[model samples]
Target: MVEGYAVGIDLGTTNSAIAAVTGDEPEIIPNSDGDRTTPSVVMIDENDETVVGQPAANQAVSKAARTVQHIKRHMGDDDYAVEIDDEQYRPEQVSALILSRLLADAEAYLGRDVDSAVITVPAYFGDAERQATRSAGEIAGIDVEHVMTEPTAACLAYGLQETGDADTSESHEKRHVFVYDLGGGTFDATLVEIDLEHNHIEVKNTDGNRRLGGEDWTQRIVDHLAEIAKEEGDVEIAGDPEQEQRLYDAAVRAKHDLSSREQTEVTVPYLGPNYNLETTLTRETLQELTADLLDQTIDEVDELFERSEHAIEEVDEVLLIGGATRMAQVQETVESYFGMEPLRSINPDEAVALGAATQAELMSASGDTTADDVLPGEEEDLLLVDVTPQPIGIELHDGDFAPVVEQDEKVPISRSDDRFTTVMDDQTGVRFPIYQGQAEEAEDNTKLGEMVLSGIPKAPAGEPTLEINFEVQSDGTLEASATHFESGESVDTTIESGVRLSEKEIEQMREALPTLKDRAVAGAEQKEA
Candidate 1:
């Protein structure tokens, strides 16, 4: 049996945070380093021991090849793996190490074991991505009570912070909020409706590019500096991982400094003997270099509103929910497009984790209750209604797509399609290739996995009727089943995702946690010594 209270985790790409609900309030749990946020970086030292967080991040320049950063972007990718010391680690495995570090700190702070948590992810993530995140939690020895969206979590924190002590019986103003989340490695534009009076929050629509974020902007700066280095110092920074990492660190510092100052100097030292590349980056130059990237986020916001029933004018408040939204260019563009300044009462970097903690509290109180079943009685009682980020369906005979669950559809839902029939006589099985996308052609969309319903009675073509059902949980996990009309035979589905780890592998990683934890502690001690 698990012990201790459930906590909330914001497993970010660049930085991760953990929070726990204390009495009626949620508080961010600082790591062992006494920091609210920990860098989502991991490195393997010369001793072949694992090191995580700030120490790992600090050594990236010297151990570039052994360092793993921004592993969140590769979650659920089949071909993506980080190789260190000739050993390959899956994305979830790397993510688990980070989660382990966060939980370890939380356990030490609370003086108790933490076995359950609610993790947040990008609002636009699909089933595979959500599954990978859950797998990471399992591997870290935590029961992932729920996998909530980042935008929704932000709204929860905002709403609770504003009305936590207010009377629930009184009527409050209803507001439509637009959440523009530009994080380290992913972006999401979500339109949410917050009814504090009714204690309800619903996600109306969401869209984003998972591959685009602040890192892309940083890369633009890195490229500019690299070009200058080669031209002036005749030093080759490109294709050299160590030099590239050094420049990346410098570029990130310059990016943050430029956020507040008009200009900041960036210097990459020891690139070569008696050579140091120095450059001055101005705020205007940073804006100019990353204008297109900023525009891409605005484009996603426009697309989000286009697909939503509420327009920009209908949005009563706009909330910026990620650290990347601190950029002046991002603020200017968002203000210009929405004609309103975004609300900044809540801390952007900490909102998601705080909200996740609030969610864990609610889930703990209302055991096994679904989101829709949550009612407003106390000030803390609120319903969070989320939706499927993408359409999921099966491939038809002509290679066209047939959607069973459309995009933006409210989740914790089940839908069935009985239009499928046997194409060949005496067919004992029917293979259903599941896909997630809005493409008209099956091949154009992302194939999530496949489920074959076997044991169908032999019959002539078109004689056997099959009813395929799809059920999407609140956490965005998908399960399927097929029922034969005449025989009353049913076969449940188990989607074999190419990018996800198997149950056996997850258990193996879970079993190895103690050994890894010891190594991490030893590595940290070694670094300090």
Candidate 2:
């Protein structure tokens, strides 16, 4: 067994939380502010130091240009970066700062150093996004033992807890579960099968939009209020960063209010000395504004059911995960679409982190091990099987995509394709551009990375047999290799997503973390003083 503590983290789009196994059950570790969840916001203070969480979130209205929120949407985007004080901060770097803050808070609460963690990500995230998340953990100076999918984690949290309390005689029945997870910046619909008596959980199929989530709902409100303000008060709130930030905050508050109230009023003051923008928003109106977004999630659910082997009626349970599930519109839509009320036995805000903590505990108790290994626990051995959410392929000479690994395929798998050949006569080398998507054309898919194989013997076009292999680990990262059958030459590489931090940059950022953390702590202390 490991000597140190390993925790589970939900590195969410709008908020983040950490959990650890205490005694026999997983429990959330509160931050220094005694909050169960910390806002996923970061800021550069006046002193040129980093600050995170609520303190940083407080500055969004006052210092809009220096503060960044919702960085998760840009996880795998190579072209996006936040510029603060002439310094460029990549999405991973900003996310790392948030992770570091969570870890520091956990350490302070536990009074011990954390050894490692299992971080959760959206199941539909492709290889590039998953790799970027792992990189964020590295930059945060934490050993990311695994990157479990959010839906799978939610199911684990639910299945294990239910089994722990169930009668042994009644636990033998196999059940199908549909996990509907809508967080701040992403949505995932997953079909899962579980047999508690056998301690088995398998993801049958998964689909989602990485860009659709609660924030989009909030943006709808923001746009509505901005347009109303322009029309009623003749105040321009669109282009001004500070005013936009104020309106955003107000919109978020109104959204939360409408979750439990019939109607809520948003009042954004200080737009001008004598001008105050005030408007009333109803839950019905909010639903009307974001109806298309809700439909998008339902569309994903429809696609999931269509692709999976199980039918909608076969699902015995529907589990709702993420804070956004609290909205009445989301709950109503899900219940209506599934023809049954979704279960929320566990706190939607903490289910993913709790499930991750459960997995981490299993790993620590059994010694460091992979998901395939059945770690002996107090009760029984648990086996989790996850699948790839998107198809991975190589671009052919005709600009078509040839998929090597199809979506919904089981993970910790390896497959090879030998249909590729030399495109030109006497071609000594070939570069294969890899992509991830369902698109027929290579240009339409997302390019993950490229692998080059050289030193091929001179041959006529289509004469050389070239084999390409893809191996996906349990955590969803990809490694690829190519071989020339005639020359018996081979080359392999772990796919590096485009424009992410380099090894040198990661190391540099890791080294700078402690100082950045200290400065943040000092700043907090100064504020309290």
Q: How high is the CA lDDT of each candidate model?
A: 0.84, 0.86
Query: Which candidate gets the maximum TM-score versus the true structure?
Result: 2
Off by over 4 Å in 2: 365-379, 457-459, 486-489, 496-503, 512-529
TM for every model, in the order presented, reads 0.90, 0.92
Number of backbone clashes in candidate 2: 0
lDDT of 2 by residue, 490-516 (tens): 999987565456779899867654234
- The prediction achieving the highest lDDT against the true structure is 2
Tens digit per residue, CA lDDT, model 1, 1-529: 5448779999999999999876557899998778899999988766666778887888888778888999999988766788776778888989999999899889989888886899999998887788889899988889889989999999888876765445544425777988999999999999998887667899999999888988998999999898888888888887899989988988899888877789999888787667888778899999989888988888888777778887789988889988888888888888888899889898999999998987886777434433323223344456789998889999987899999988899978999999999899999888889998778998887788888878889999999999989998775667888888988878786664445667798998676542343534645565785
Candidate 2 collision pairs = none
Model 2 compared with the native: what TM-score?
0.92
